[model samples]
Target: TELQSAQRKAAWADVARRIAHEIKNPLTPIQLSAERLKRKYLKQIDTDPETFATCTDTIVRQVEDIRRMVNEFSDFARMPNPVLAREDLRGLVSAALVLQRTAFPTIIFTAELPEDPVIVQCDGGQIGRALTNLLKNAVEAIEARKGNDLPPGRITTHIVRTEQHTTAHITDNGKGLPVENRDRLTEPYMTTRVKGTGLGLAIVKKIMEDHGGALVLEDAAGEGARASLVFAQGNGRAGA
Candidate 1:
């Protein structure tokens, strides 16, 4: 029994990790192109139209999210060594929005960033996954709060540079995380959602630590939640 359990898990984990790494290489461009078309043409097609274009766009966006999360699962099973590169945080954030914009057409996506590019040493694929997860969570929160009494929500992301660290923060306007859940949010297999592997946040935390960064969860000021990733400042290529 024990041997079966150990071997099965090990095999599954390897498969997952390999899948994540293999698919990861092409996911970005596919997602970005789909996003560009969705943003500029979602309206052009029809009217959230359930028409061909609109339907295709929505499907692409959702598939991208699934792919994004799947990447996390893959990372959990088998992670690659840090392919550290000089990356611009702003570009990563924008690309994340581009991939996800369709999911929250109603929820306002806001950005606060510096005029100059802020660069960090990171694995673009993994770090991008982290940001996407945060944004996805924000959108999910906004969706859950949608109802008779609740108004539409907003998600705000920002990158700030301190003397020694670069911090990327994501905040959302929705029912704030309960006090009890805060401590367990990053723990594997812990989530309020009926369907969640609960590995997204855990993957984010692991990626951060691997790159000399830290992930923080705090109560948002008004009615939602804020998450931040702080990374050690490093010299980087000026552009993304």
Candidate 2:
């Protein structure tokens, strides 16, 4: 059964690679065409310059969005093996929070890291990306509840190390996951946000798997969502 599951995952990875390659081939041309249209027609339409500019701007923006989606697909399809090394997990978490704090000024971000380094053999870049994605999703959830009479948004990151595993918990005081389809949140193209491509969580899951880790989701104690990245403890065992 485990072998079959592995085969299924490999098959899906191959499919993702092929699909991402085919979809990415034409994005460059489309993006260029949109940019050219904006540049060539911005001043040509003298009668209604505002309307012309708005239309071309919309085209450019939408093309950029498509390009971003394509890149995410490519990242998922071509995820590499983690280059493991002993590193400080606290610094990685702090770095991710710093970037998110700049992006979301209104949200209160906090971290609880041990004074002594919690060393883990991991690909720092990939793990950092996962952290950033989790933070981004938390911010988006909070933003989704705008206009409601709610308290200030808060996101907390806490790291726990045990004898057998290390876990990083990211909790947010925002909208929690839906009870019905929560299990499918990491599947591709499953998103609740209008503008989301739904690949963020999927990519994070892949990265965790690549590192012999797991990505877990749950509802926070009172409200909002909590995501955990769990890594197994071993005697310097490298992930395949």
Candidate 3:
């Protein structure tokens, strides 16, 4: 795996370099090609219209996913500076939920917060990325351990305010983490995913620490995991 990973990284680096070199070099009509795929002409044989739709849908969806992966790779190669300012956590989380709803259609994701605004000082873009990664990981974890055709999963976001600190707890009904990996959860280059870069949680941890906060992993109520980001409250912004 290591050797393959190294080779793949080398290949990816070369591709990325070339992408940077050739302005609009990714000129292949991949989307168009997929669109023009052969379709069964026989009306009776193709009576099941659903089959064709599914095939086309899957191809287009996966192609878009690959494009996203490449875009993330590009971003990671040259991460931009954070546009720091006051960010409304509730609104930000809501926006992320909109994005996640598409990827995890069956997973019920909810946000629980006080009516009052819980504003923090940070980069909205970076924080959004952190939230999306955590949500995506939870969804995949749940889907994997869904033993016996279990029903769809759910995630709950609870924002609590204390005298000294604000805590945001994201709880999922996915596979729970081993107690042993708790301490190592945020370690860079550490992960349980086969294709993971092992950097999502690390990036998240950096975000928390960057904002005078800490990202803590804990057990969820019934199942799954809870990643809590604890930060100083009192209406003060993060990184401000």
Ranking by lDDT: 2, 1, 3
State which candidate, 1 or 3, has the greater lDDT: 1
Shift of residue 37 alpha carbon in model 3, Å = 3.6
lDDT of 2 by residue, 41-71 (tens): 7777779788877876787788777777877
Instruction: Rate residue 201 of model 1 by lDDT.
Output: 86
Cα lDDT of model 1 overall?
A: 0.80
| Ranked candidates, highest TM-score first | 2, 3, 1
Displacement of residue 106 (Cα, Å) in model 3 is 1.4
Ten consecutive residues with minimal summed lDDT in candidate 2?
231-240
The residue-by-residue lDDT of candidate 1 on 1-240, one tens digit each, is 999998888888887777777777777777677777667766666444456566667767777777857755776766555698888889999899887777668888989989997888788988898899889888887787745867668899998887878998999987778677778899876788765778878888888888878999888997899999898765353553
Which ranges in model 1 have alpha carbons more than 4 Å from their true place?
Answer: 1-12, 15-72, 235-240
Per-candidate TM-scores read: 0.71, 0.80, 0.72
Global lDDT scores for all candidate models: 0.80, 0.86, 0.73
Clash number for each model: 0, 0, 1
Off by over 4 Å in 2: 1-46, 234-240
Predicted structure 2, TM vs. truth: 0.80
Residue 113 in model 2: lDDT = 93
In angstroms, the error of model 3 at 49 is 16
